[model samples]
Target: MKRTLSAAALVLLAVVALPTAANALEGDSYGPGSCNSITPASVARGAAVSYSCSDFWVANQTVSITIDSSAAGVSARTLSTVADAAGDIQVSIDTAADPAGTYTLTATQGTVTDSSDFTVLDPADAAAAAASASDPSAGGNALADTGFAGTALPWVAGGLLAVGAAALGTVVVRRRQQA
Candidate 1:
């Protein structure tokens, strides 16, 4: 009877201890006061090349923004603020005048700073860049280093405690049976 009770307790404990792992879909890499880069700041012939901040950033905070492209000689001279909560920011630049080259997108507000270096490729480039953007590996979070980075003793101790409890229960059951 004691052995059966001990085995049942261990099974129950294991069942309660199990944690549901959060998959990539359920997790949001951008959590609070973080910035992201969106691609292809579009523009017409002479109109200001358009740049945008994501709604994720805009809707989350009222941020100070200055979108400038020295290479294109065009800038977003709006007020010192913009918001992108859905993870988008749109501003315009001189697409016709400036030669095709890489341009920098810098947004700094609060404690977050984000930058994206985009190339002036034909429309074909948009699809490729968009594909790369969609990849989970490309997003901002630390990819190579995740989970259990710093000191990892708590887990070990917990496992040892569970094992000790099982062993003690087994010993008690054996003693009772012998007596």
Candidate 2:
């Protein structure tokens, strides 16, 4: 039993450590940036966002950052820059001119690609906001708030009861058999 447990522990340790090793080996491709992340996932309309991406294998390679907007009035924009030594690039995007909506930003070098989503929210209206705050049911619907309204709750409760009864019956049967 001790040997078996030791073997199992070793297997578990290997399973956990393998992913970290694999991830460390997986750096940027010869074409695309490797380590990339964006800060502040959502923001007000027309705000600046910061992003960093690394292309360790492809040092000094040019990368293109493209911004695609859902709003029709605004056209997609692209910016290009070369990565620094150690394959790192840092940039800020100016959203102030973009319309309020979701935008996808993609960075590409050759065949490698990484993308992030950003949100721009519209400013709230004063009178409409005031009316909703004053009225208890103004902004939100009662039916939607309940989530599992109508017959759903009842069916869920009945299902729980059935499961409980089956578990109780199994316990009782096992006890009678032991007795």
Candidate 3:
């Protein structure tokens, strides 16, 4: 009984300590930036679109920005800028010369990189897109959905923890009965 309880306690301790240990191993390493988004995700041919990124950048470091499109005859564009003290970046690019298509904007600093996609629309489509963006009921802007909206990982983790607790309780109860 003593051995069983000790083993269970050790297992529980390891489970709780694992996350902390992993965090320690990640010390000072810049993770990839997130909250990468483009405002006015869909734009008319001559409109200006804004790109913004938050977090995960090395402070005050130079960041390389690249805009690439898979559309035929569209050459890639490159620019360089520095991230602010809070590791955030924002830029605007004119879509006047860009053909109607989807473009991906990537920002890289040190080992961290983030990317977002926006669309340059034809005049007719751009009007429709603008209308949709203005109406929240129409689903708002077309920013990438990076949320945990439909993930099952949380449920799985909770189920596992509950199972572990139940198993430990069963072990303790069995030990008490045997005593």
Best candidate, lDDT:
3
Residues 55-88 of candidate 1 have per-residue lDDT tens digits of 4454545555443455555554333455654645
Off by over 4 Å in 1: 1-30, 33-36, 41-50, 58-81, 84-88, 121-179
Output the better candidate (1/3) by lDDT. 3
Candidate 2 C-alpha lDDT tens digits along 1-179:
45445554665575558656767655544344455566666665566787787553257889898989878887899998788887788889887787778889888888877788877665454345445656767764333345544875675576557655655665566668679
Compose the digit string of candidate 3's lDDT tens values, residues 58-102.
679999999999999999999988888978888889999999999
* Shift in Å, residue 66, candidate 3: 0.6
Worst 10 residues of 3 by lDDT: 27-36
The lDDT of each candidate is 0.54, 0.69, 0.81
lDDT of residue 26 for candidate 3: 56
Candidate 2 Cα errors over 4 Å, as ranges: 1-34, 55-57, 123-179
From the highest TM-score down, the ranking of the candidates is 3, 2, 1
**TM-score against native, each model:** 0.36, 0.53, 0.65
